[model samples]
Target: MSRLITIDNGGTLTDVCVIDGQQVAYTKTLTTPHDLSRCLFDGLERVSHEVGDARSLPALLRTTDYIRYSTTQGTNALVQRVGPRLGLLVDDPRILEDLAREEETADLYAALVGSRSAVLDLGVDDETLEGELVTVCNRLAAEGASRFVISVGGPDGAVAERRIRDLLLAIFPRQLLGAVPLLFSNELIGGDDDVRRTWSSLLNAFLHPAMERFLFNAESRLREHRTRNPLLVFRNDGASSRVAKSAAIKTYSSGPRGGVEGTRALARHYGLDEVLMVDVGGTTTDLAMVRDGAVDIDWFGTVAGVTTSLPLARITSHGIGGSSVFHVTDGVLGVGPRSVGAAPGPACFGLGGTQATITDVLLLTGVLDSSTYLGGTFRLDVDRSAAAVRATIADPLGIDLPEALTRMQDTYAARMAEVLRTEAGPATTIAAFGGAGPMSICAAARRAGVPNVVIPRSAAVFSAFGIGFSDIGQTYRTAAGDRPDDAAVTAAIEELLAHAERDMFAENIAIADCELTWAVVDAAGATTPLGGRDDAARALKAGGRVQLQVVAVLPHPRLEDPVAISHTAFESSGTRAVADATGTRSEVPVVDLARQEHGAEGHGPLVVEGPFFTMFVPDGWTVAVSGSGDLLLTDIPGSSKEND
Candidate 1:
């Protein structure tokens, strides 16, 4: 049987999902930031055992059809601002010369370039310019700036940019040892907006070195395993591309994009068009909207408040997750923008962590079972969790342990509710997933006034599952002027299509099997499909100016769908004391979903345990197991339930 594998390298965990024809296996391992490949291979080895394959990289690689990977490392780097020091080389010295003359403008320019960046002026003198370029490169190198961005202004910037690129190549000579990497603005972005182009180049240059190190290392490991199919990397554009063709800027928040794609698939299965997708991972919670059965794409995406021209799936990310640090600040409790990552993890993990986190709160409150966490692979320490909470939150506030726990849950639910209220429209269904999604979803949904919540069986590694579902695709775009003639528009579109075709050919995708589609965005921001018709170009003149986008999609081979789950009977494993919103403890039924049959229905005050996650059903809620093994949670009528 042909098999497909996907791995999502998250902030706190490396999730692996393997699909072998009709069977599927999922697992997670602690992410090793010091060396991510270690955790990646570790997770793969464990998953291979579940699929009944030899526990060796080469064996699994030879048997699997393809592997797709997604990661949040780029987003983390941008948010933390902890990348290589950068240097800016501007082709036009006039701009810098003018800014230097004005103190206020110079300060503003410095702020824009950041404190760690060194900006240099490239004058018109060819001899002096080459010398100046080398001198500045050495100077920036001395100051610890190993990566450089060369941006040129004016209409002829591309030509001047190429000259600077050639000069840098001659000086640095990439073949030489300790050679620094240089990025050019015109190659990454096509536009007259000098500011946007410069920012894009700077961001790309900052993220390039680390991304290259990890991705290329991972690729080399795969090659050692005799993997023939290319290792596809997920992009923020909701598609997968070869590692060589991917840009680091396009990979920001790419892990969350996979969740968005899975949400779309779920929407299709359930026949719901409008839904609110919430993905609660260890480090962040990502929210997005699917209206009319389609996910929205941000044509002009933004990273760290800086505008970029890369097309990305529109997802709202908040610093709330399972590993979010919880602290009492000035007698006020707050959840995080800070996380106790995989090294120490949550206090409940008992790996030398002292910080109280959301995970600790969940364990202390009995939302997670100590013995059954990660299906008994990783045991949790409830006592450690309680002690951390007592020290960090309870004692600081002079409140009892139960009250402090309740307060933590309340604050977390309130924050999630606020985000939902701000981002989601009224009367939207919520589809929640991720390792932490099921635990907090009920409370967050009730607070957000969402009536229905669906947590799929593959919720823990849902993002990795989504990566397996994505198509191999690439998009090319070019800027067009106002009222351009048909010939100009035609030529531009042809150029983009040709580029896409060439890229696809390199990836071994044939022209006939691939699908080509085109769209034009006018100056007024209205997009009209070209539909392979040249007549559509006439509409561009009416809208002022336009830009053409051409896309080529090569869909992955379809595998067998998930095996249907049969409902035989409902069996309770045991009873556990779970705390409620009021901090009162009561015996709650713990049901094993694997033992339950299709159409199995149950009441609330219970824990529906799965291999990867656990769902807490409150007193007034009801749940049913679908034929596909999906757990559906709903509120019962005439029953009052307090938010947890």
Candidate 2:
């Protein structure tokens, strides 16, 4: 039997899963922030111990068909400010230069600068741009700048961005110098959010060096274990793509993606049309939406407080997690954005962390296992947890430890519930995952008035299972001109589709089975069904049409520009207010229904679980699992293949 290995890097632990074609064995270990790979390898080794094949484990895992890794390397890099002071070079340096200047004003600018390129024309001359880029690179290199990011103004100028990066890299390979992970603004977001995109790119650069070494070390360790398969790294976007060399952004929020994917699958299995997945891990709580067994992807989700267009699920993250440290703020009681990370974890772990944390409260209150944390690999110190809670919370609130702990938990749950309510609205089932998720899911769901909560088997391994379920997808978007005509919109779609094809080709995806889908949100933000312009126009006119927005959904993951191309496109004024009287403001039509045929088998009350993630499938619902292994929920079980 082929073995599949999945790694989930939680805030305080690294959860590893080894699936021998069917039954899965899993293990967890403390995370080593200084060297994350240490925990990754350790987790894998432990899993090998469980399966009784330490010597042959690596070789078996190597010959395995798939290997997926999910971690927070990029996320950590940004949080710690570990990268070199970045010097940004822009095609148009007005706004970005100003923002960079402002950041420098806080006495934080050790070495950073922003300058405009000498190239003046749209059709960039390689000779001039290359020379100028090399000059910029040399200056930054000498001034102790270890990382650099370049952003040009126009959205369609990828060739220019590539040329500039290639020239600079010729002077510095991965080993010779710290990585300057080049991300062209246009390449990442399709359109221009120069400042935000540049910030995203810079953040990626900051994470590159650390992640490069981490992946290499992991690869080396795997080789020592006789593993020969290429490492399949999970991207923040819920897709597993092979890492060619070293790209750091791919691993950010790996654990969260697993939750989203698992939720999507569960939704399909149980036929739940709308779901809100809440996963509380040691470090953070993540909330995401799955409508009709499909999780939404913003293509460019916000990260580290910066927005970029990456193929990531639309997940809302809060600082509240299992190991979040608790403190009293002016005697009002506060929970955390700060966590008792891995080395010295929560007081409950008995690892020397004296801080009163969520885990401590859970342990003291009998909500968590005192003996089975990490399945007994690590022991919980109930005494330390109780003492910490009493010393910190009880004294501050002038109440007993139990009461203070209960109140603190209530407060955290209330805040999380409010956010979930706003995002999920009414009648959405809560599918909770993560080590702490099952323990708290029922209580949180009860508070939120959510009627159903589903907890699956091996809940801790849900994220790893999700790693097996996700598809490779890309979404490309560009802002439209204020007054776009149908013809103009059509032209834009064609251009985007062409670009999508090119991108897919670069990724080595086949063209025969590929498809194109488009979603257009004009300046106004209204959506029109693809090629249903007459219907869209009528909807707009019905409410004294002022303006409209448009969005398109492509069913195929192989589609190049999932958001930019379609023949029968959705078009509107681009805004809710302009969408007329009808609330059908955003229309998504299946341009190629054939793409949906790749359906996966599912059942009611389906519980899709993964390492550190779980997706609850409600009862009495039928879902369509597509050829891409994508889930689509239907209200009436097995009634319709297409949602529309």
What C-alpha lDDT does candidate 1 achieve relative to the native structure?
A: 0.74
Q: Write the per-residue lDDT of candidate 2 for residues 393-483, one digit (tens) a residue.
A: 8887899755786677676666566656766654787766677675545345545656466554446667766675654444455543345
**Model 1 segments more than 4 A misplaced:** 53-55, 76-148, 152-182, 325-334, 337-339, 393-399, 480-490, 523-527, 533-569
Minimum summed lDDT over a 10-residue window in model 2 is located at: 572-581
lDDT of 1 by residue, 124-159 (tens): 567777888777777777877667777777655655
lDDT of all predictions, in order shown?
A: 0.74, 0.58
Please list all clashing residue pairs in model 1, or write none if there are none.
567-597, 567-598, 568-597
Highest TM-score against the true fold, candidate:
1
